[model samples]
Target: MSENARVTKAAGVVGAATFLSRIFGFVRDVVIAWFFGAGLSSDAFFVAFRIPNLLRRLFAEGSLSIAFIPVFTEYLTHHGKEEAFHLARSAMRLLSIILVITAVLGVLLAPLIILMIAPGFTDSPEKYSLTVLLTRIMFPYIFFICLVALCMGILNVLGHFAAPALAPVCLNIAIIFSAFFISPYMADPVTGLAIGVLIGGALQLTLQLPFLIRKGFYFWEKAVIFHPGVKKIGILMLPAIFGASVYQLNILVGTLLASLLPEGSVSYLYYADRLVQFPLGIFAIATATAVLPSLSRQAAAKDFDALGNTFAHAMKLVFFITVPSMAGLI
Candidate 1:
């Protein structure tokens, strides 16, 4: 098949898988709404959820994947799969260390972090305390979700799109179950959601492991920080993190600013952003996921012409799909 056709087909599979995941996500949100609604616990949970989620986008799937995939592809192309796996293992170790440290700091300083992000919460001690408590419960999610991103990056680069794209459904399923079943037994219902977030994150990562191992991917016993591939990924990820995490940062800054608005503003924007994210989660990510593997191949083969065409094709698809969808949502 032609390159364009191949990319389109791959993207279709990813888009479908992502669509299913989003449906489950929406169901999870509805379950939350049914139990929590737009109130103190809900708002607190939104803040709690957004913190780790922002980091997930920043370091895991968003910028990290963009930077990691190309460098990974480069390694895979010239060095072969074994060497590429070596690079992946080393990169995973470095990423895990950073995420674990950040997650720990986030948990330890949850109250302070909440104060900084949503200072207005201070006016209501109840909300403020709840946010901190939930943040502590959920902060470790950053580590798991980021690890999921790393695994997804490897799968995507290996041309296994469905596994990464579909993995999110596990998260949605876990949360749905937590909301319906686990929350009743918890001290606070929102705590159940927090527990679900942790479970979902781990599940997302674990679901991909067997498939990855079958493909010969394995974790490195120790992190090789000075590995050339690790260095290259770090160099690329620094700037790319800023670029890739733009959406998450935008919403986060917006959320912080919302603290100055009337109460419930944070939750309103949180839900609104989720609505926008639905389509983006579907088409934009699908396009990116499919393009990255093919684009990496073209670039690896020094086929700039094919690379340019692939990039253009992806942009065209994204624009054509997103413009109308965003307009309709608005």
Candidate 2:
């Protein structure tokens, strides 16, 4: 198929899968509201979840995928599949070690982190303690989800979009299952949601593994610790990480201010943000995800004309969908 057609087809697949995930996510939110309402537990859960969720976006899905894909695609286009796979394996090994250490530190520093993000929680000792506990419980999710993100980058480079796009549906399903099945039995019902986050992250990583293995990308293979591609990815990732961090810091500031508001203010903001994210995730992110591999290949091939056309096509598609959605929201 042609490049434009390929991009469109991939975007459609991703958008459809994201639509399903968002629907499930909406249901999950409704279940949470029904079970916990928008008070202390809900507020605490949102704050705790936000910390790791922010890190996930910053380090894993956003920066890591953005950096890894171009480099991985270049390796595939120029070097060969074997070289690309080696780079992926090397990245997987190194990332796993870093994520393990980060998770451990996040768990240990949950109190300090929570204090920095939501100082007003200190006013309510119970809320503060619960948020810290939940944060600790969910910190390990970062490890699983980041691995999933790496798998996603590799798969996308290999021309597989459906599995990666559908992975998030697993998360919403896990959370919904926890709300109905697990929370009732827990001493603190909100703790179940935290458990759900971990389960969802693991499930996402698990969902990607069979696909990766089928494509000959095995995690168990010996990896090069200091691969040159890994260094290049690291270099590309640093700036992206910084940009995401700045955006997240803005979010953290908002969360901090929200924590100081009325009891349900945090939950209110969280719900509104989710609503806004629905359209953005479905079209905007899907389009970008679909085009990345194509753009990377064109650049690798030094096909500047093709690259310009592909970039323009993606921009037009994004504007077509997002403009109307934004107007409707307004």
Candidate 3:
């Protein structure tokens, strides 16, 4: 298949998967709203979810995947699969250590984080405590989701899109199930949502594993502590984190401000943001995800012309789809 056709087809797969995920996500939101309403519980849950979700966007999906893909693709193109797989293992090891530390710290610092992000919650001691508890429960989600992001980068480089694209659907379904089946039994019903986040994250990671192993990317091997490709990914990730997460930072700021508003303000903004993310995820993100491996390979081969063409094609496709979606939303 031609490069353009390959990218277009991959995008279609990812977009379709993302569309399904978004639909389930909407249903998840509805279930939460039906049970919790836009009150203290809902607001607390949203704020709790937002902290880890922001980190997932900023570090996992935004930085790690973006930085890991090109480097991993380059390893595959020039150095061969064995060496590339070595780098993948090394990256996973380092990421696991870092994520473990981060999750631990996040749990310990949940109160301080909640204070910084939603100071107004302090006005209601109950809300503040609940948010802190929920935040701690969901903080570990960052660990699982980031690993899933690394798996996504590897799989996408290996020409697999469906599993990673379908990952979010697992999260949505998990949350919906928890809302219905688990929340009723919980002492604090909203606590179930936090547990769902962790379960969803684990399911996302689990879904990628069999596909990865089938492609000969197993996790059982000992990892190099200082692989060169891992170093390069780290270097690339610093800039990528800031570059890709400016919008997320804006949302974080919005979340902080929303905390100062009425009781339901945070939940209101969360729902609205979900509506906007639906189209963006299905089109813009899918196109970028599909194009990355191709662009990376072309660049690795020093095929500048092909790289430029692929980039241009992706940009045009994103605009063609997203502009109309944007207009409709407006």
TM-scores for all candidates: the values are 0.96, 0.99, 0.99
Question: Which residue runs of candidate 1 sit more than 4 Å off their true CA positions?
Answer: 220-223
The candidate, 1 or 2, that scores higher on TM-score is 2
lDDT of 1 by residue, 217-279 (tens): 867445466688888888887887778666666777887888767777887887777788899
Clashes of 3: 0
Please give the RMSD to the true structure for each candidate, in Å.
1.5, 0.8, 0.8
Each model's lDDT comes to 0.87, 0.94, 0.94
lDDT of 2 by residue, 184-271 (tens): 9999999999999989999999999999999998777877878999999999999999888987888899999999998988999999
Q: Which runs in model 2 stand beyond 4 Å of their true positions?
A: none
Ranking by lDDT: 2, 3, 1
Better of 1 and 2 by lDDT: 2
